[model samples]
Target chain A: MSPSKSPLIAVVDYGLGNLRSVSKALELTGAEVIVSSKPKDLLSASGVVFPGVGAFYRGMENLRERKLNSALFKIIKEGKPFLGICLGLQLLFTFSWEHGDTKGLDIIEGRVKRFEGNVKVPHMGWNQVKQTQDSSPKTKDLFQGIPDNSYFYFVHSYFVVPKDKSLIAATTEYGGEFTSCVCKENIFGVQFHPEKSGPLGLQILKNFIDIINDSQT
Target chain B: MFSKRIIPCLDVKDGRVVKGINFVNLRDAGSPTEQAKVYSNENADELVFLDITASSDHRKTMLEVVKATAEQVFIPFTVGGGIRNIEDIRTLLHAGADKVSINTAAVENPKLVKDASWEFGSQCIVVAIDAKRKKSVTSNQNPEWEVYTYGGRKPTGIDVVEWAREVESLGAGEILLTSMDRDGTKEGYDLELTRSVSEAVNIPVIASGGVGKLEHLYDGLTLGKADAVLAASIFHYGEYSIKQTKQYLKDKGIPIRL
Candidate 1:
């Protein structure tokens, strides 16, 4: 495929609400965005952004129904940049216990577990995220120009525990340290909503756009 | 670490701002989308657009405002006031509202809270509770708060604490607790009412109404044990910028993003 002047980013629309904010944020970062539920549209894009908010089982069910599962697999296998947000991030893991034992895409080996003990269930609002020291150099580039401990808007009940420790890009302290960001090869996932996270969050999206632009060259 | 949030609330009517915004650089001050852009640029953690429009026909105007704001502003925002059913919530969420708050509707139909949270995620469903101190309490009895409906006009006679617990159990992710007595008086938040409901629920509680000064904001987060504070007048009157408020909270040893 010939490299276009502007990278077209496909935001996977697997029957979830609130894709407007995600697509709008990406558009502001100078990337052409197409909120598409069609699998072929996702495969043709330079980068794919999988964003959703809801139950893990419902999200996977929609993906399978829309045939987005195979498109996502192809995007990752073909080395296209993939960014996942919130439930989009959780769906990349092995499985989740959200409504029951639900299987995920297994792109990353991990279990989506609930927040237990005395802390709040959803873990809503702003929290500081520190980049893990073991993050790879390319993963560190994801946080480029973003200050450490910047606050991001997060609203989630479950957290991911990646089996491969190297995939952990950042950790945040809720009751204890849980993986907030994960990066491996061309895949990146964040538990927080970067679209809703203000400037620093926009910077993360800008960085992803930059990565896509660089790869196209 | 979780930072206590300082959210600025805007009263929008018929897709325009009802309250005066004291910010200097606004091109169109009355436009809700423009004001939202200014607030988001001022480092506001989040925004709440309370549509006080009386007629249900004006909801389409509010949806346009939400769509415009979502297109321009990057921060998270919640739209409340006059939301009645699941269809109303779905439209706002689809139009780019990160969350939709239900007050009178949630009180009237408790099952709406359960069904809405079940359909959309609980994280996007915020149940706003307007509570007033129950009158005629004897000296021997502990002071209690009664839930008010229809924008704090009618008393529901329901215990504020019990209502908060019920909504949380019904799958509310957060509670926007507003004290009616202290709303316009500006003395301070009813710390007792706030703490009781905050301590009773496992979800995050946002203390609303009666923030006269920076100290009042500090007290609400500390003594009231609230996860966030929502104020309209203080930020509107140019009394303090969001950065100044966060700085004060941070100095008071409260965990806030600077």
Candidate 2:
């Protein structure tokens, strides 16, 4: 892939989350990765990846405080291929009970709730994610070239519950069934970290690139 | 079920594997990145790189090694040793480490643990505790384990169980519990110490040190109730491959990646 023709994807930096590893992984997939906090830089990118690593309330607070929420909404509104990771995925929901009821982006009608049952909190390590029964951008692109039930690295205590189960692109089992990947039009959110999820993880990033390429045409 | 993790740890001094370079330790252990790649290929669940260097000059070298290893090895990797503050954690994470293990610093200034947990998120902060079993459990004596710092040279007099609970509440996501007495002895893990700490906390505990054979790994998980087992010498010296270790765990009906 020519450098000039390669997609310049912006990894939105809200002063939180692991941006370096994501940037490095994106670069390896032949995309020009940029760690940018500026709204203009993120908006101008061919693809935007919003990632988070902290509490739910803090994540929304940072996004709003840095004016990234508006910038992110604008990027999504423009039909850009947007990817939200972990807490970034939760931020798109309506509210989270993480630290006493925090509001989210509401881009998708969902509520983030803590995992409760006999299982351990902060569900770490690799677990299988099965693609939903449909042929959309998710199975057709985000997870393209990857098999269903493929294991991916996950580390989160709370999982998002989309109001419409149809919005769930993939599902994973921890204490019980939880939405692992949610897709709504051009926006994609995954609870698992593709960067640290090993080879299949890297493949997910590459698959996103394909979606970005498809969008340009 | 979340599979039991088998982690291979490498000790580095000035960017070179300790014993391999110094000729005093183990010798011929190989470079960290090379060993790390080999472990990744062997299907080790995760890798931990400890920069045991005291010189500031080698800190940058460690970062380069971490960067190269992170670039080549595609798995969860953690870096520890000499991490004093959140800035150190940030620098290492920026170099591509998935997590940072805070030991002496977390003990000296407990606030550093809270600060790091918030800055990098609790999942990224691993509080590594080196605990030594207190002699005798008489009514007048303290609890079973005491937290030690400065390479186990200084005893903080803090109860290991209490410390384990404190770190978790302080926002630590995981604990790397090492037995100072069992370290390098290869007898097996301090099962009592591991059980006490694991039972006392809600987060995952990685039982480290004192592993001479494969059964020890099983005992660490089943007997000690640990989430993971970190072995250095046993796997580093080529006595056992990660494949064989996972097979042993599997045969014992333990949930493993293999």
Candidate 3:
């Protein structure tokens, strides 16, 4: 079958994976998705998706093992539209307190911490996300047309606590208002699984695809 | 605030969705993928597909059903029944399942819960408990429920609350609590059994079984204090839609996503 003219979205597969659902969801947005471990895919694609589940340390280790770590940094540095989900979002931070102190990609200035107090550990199920205001056009477009405080599916024990509060794109209440989304220029990371978030989640992915299509010009 | 989830469970047997009344008298609903899409489009928070096929050879059929559903239906779904090992969990996850629920397997070897949780994170491990209320001499006596396995056909003799606590310690992210007596009777969820287990575990407890109407769903979340409610007959037979249930819950002052 001949390839469509849609923008190619490369989903980084570093072994700490949920590659199938992520890629399938991306494909649903009419984008050509390539689930690959090769750095070439990341560099060549119009946009990149760094989706993951499981441990932050294990995710980083797998990225390093496959030599996709530097490739990811290069893609972000090159101003390519990038989106991270769940652990993928956590992997962008400076370090995490999960298990022991584990260093992350340091792409964003933040520390990942576990939920404390009366809150549930996983923070699972549907929760409302309130979008934050930022001057970045990309940040605004990320949640464009999507209503503020819309419910998104979340399932994570640790959340990113970014040092630069301005980078936070959205916040959700659990224990007490943790960062649900982070945006810096073209880099976007969401704590919830947009792929599993139903229609609104599909809308979020469609927005990301729109961002990618808009960036091509 | 986190919204209470309303899940519609589909029991798939030989690739079709079926709801067995008390684990027998099976009634065919429709295709697994079709029913899943309907529930998803209706905005059900999550979906659970329990493979009730007795033969192990039909596992491939279930996998195909899962793959098809994952491709079309874009909601978080959990697959359960006969998931006995790590490979079963891994295969289901690879097929695009968000979580896997283990029942008989987890009871036989509690290590599977620890190992699966360690390998794939506790967030994806859901321990399903099918419990039956034990006979009590007097109304003043403290009530007790015993865990049952093999589609509620065999009793494990293990106390429900204690087992729930044990699984939570074993790293289960959530518990799918089903009351055997209330499962098909439609007398509403076994509130006592649900509350006991919910109070025992810190992780989320999804109250399942015996949901006949919108009020039952409300009762499960309010009185039972379960994080989520799962029902098959009400949804499978189109007695009530997820939207109606959520609206009813919302009207009744329960936090639900509509």
Q: Best by DockQ, which number?
A: 1
DockQ of 3: 0.75
Model 3 regions lying over 4 Å from their true place? A1-5, B20-29, B136-138
- What DockQ does each candidate score versus the true complex, computed on alpha carbons? 0.85, 0.54, 0.75
Candidate 3 structure, TM-score to reference? 0.95
Estimate, for each residue in A142-214, the C-alpha lDDT of model 2 and write its tens digit.
Answer: 8777888887888888999999888889999887899999998999999999988777888999988878887
Cα deviation in Å at residue B157, candidate 2? 1.6
Please give the TM-score that candidate 2 achieves against the real structure.
Answer: 0.92
For candidate 2, the per-residue lDDT at B66 reads: 86
Report the number of clashing residue pairs per model: 0, 2, 0
Ranked by DockQ from best down, the candidates are 1, 3, 2
List candidate 2 segments past 4 Å from native. Answer: A1-5, A135-137, B20-30, B138-143
Worst 10 residues of 1 chain B by lDDT: B134-143
User: Which candidate leads in lDDT?
Assistant: 1
Name the TM-score of chain A in model 2. Answer: 0.96
Clashing pairs in 1: none
TM-score of chain A of each: 0.96, 0.96, 0.95
Better of 1 and 3 by DockQ: 1
The deviation in Å at residue A187 for candidate 2 is 1.5
